[model samples]
Target: MANHRAAWTDERAEQVIGELLRVGVILSVVVILIGAVFYFLHHPAARANYRTFHSEPDDLRSIARIAAGAVKLRPREFIQFGLLLLLFTPVARVAFSVFAFAAERDRTYVIVTLIVLGILISSIVGHI
Candidate 1:
């Protein structure tokens, strides 16, 4: 009876861990897709505009002016850039954790995934 109960508990734990891993994979995919859309929509245009105005900047004065203009970004633009980078960090962490898990098949990855998810969720909720 004791052996049967222990086996059932072990099986249940495995099922729960599997479900968590699936959720982590799905969340990571969604985060990456959203980040890609945002980067294409936002950063590429700004970079193009900056390139158009600055060109090669062959001298010190031109470089100074470009630097000054870059530093003069609007508050909203800064926030958008920060948010884009912030969004990528967790996705990257999850990708690394997945790789770590696949390479070693270690249980430590389950804890790492949970920590990353907790941090991401807290940041999203606290910021809003």
Candidate 2:
């Protein structure tokens, strides 16, 4: 009975993780679409200038600033933030896995997941 319960718990954790990823993707897409709607509505006359590209301002480059801009209803910034969310989904999954492993008392996986998470965080932060 104890062994069956353990297996069931592990299965449940995997299911939850899968669901989390699916929901994250869907939410990110919805946010991106909302941003797109705002962007087009606000700038009906503006056309894309992909041939002559210019980088976004420094303020919009950072996550903190992007979030602030989104809160202020800046469509472009909100789009960027949505992209940021898409990028962060995997990281969130890893973080969640670390906690799940810890809960399961799987020391090796917990340590390994933590290492992956640290590396992931450093890579993102290093650019900033």
Candidate 3:
């Protein structure tokens, strides 16, 4: 583990985190764009009405169903998955912060980041 710790120098961790954010955002945009293109292709003249409000479909509410749909190349699911990825990107960064702090041997920051991570997770899963 000495070698692993050595590899996670502060600069290295920052660079990786920066790259991770960049890649995550770009991938999310690309996925959302692809999903949009497919959606428009399938529904050239589709329109939404502001006169009514509707909740998300039951099938699309859960992660398992979303993954299943996205895997099947469903356009809406792709869009949803992209949005999910976008939302998860920050959560992931916070999670990595715990490791980054631990690698730097900063116990206080590690604990703080863990608390933040826990809060993020609870907020995400709390409504369920």
lDDT of 1: 0.50
* C-alpha TM-scores of all predictions: 0.32, 0.86, 0.86
In angstroms, how far off is 90's CA in candidate 2? 0.7
Please identify model 2 stretches exceeding 4 Å from their true place: 1-8, 126-128
Q: Give the higher-lDDT candidate: 1 or 3.
A: 3
Worst 10 residues of 3 by lDDT: 58-67
Task: Write model 3 residue lDDT over 1-128, tens digit each, in one string.
Answer: 65887677779889989998998999999999999998899888999776877888855677677778889889898888888889889999999889999988989999999999998898868333
lDDT of 2 at 23: 86
Question: What lDDT does each candidate get?
Answer: 0.50, 0.86, 0.86
Model 3 TM: 0.86
Ranking by TM-score: 3, 2, 1
lDDT of 2 by residue, 1-128 (tens): 66843553567788988998998888889989999999999999997678876887876888888998999989999888888888998999899888788778899999999999999999878455
Query: Model 1 over residues 1-128: C-alpha lDDT tens digits?
Result: 65643343434555655665666566655544654565566555554345356543332223233334324543333334344444555465565555445445556866787677677666646333
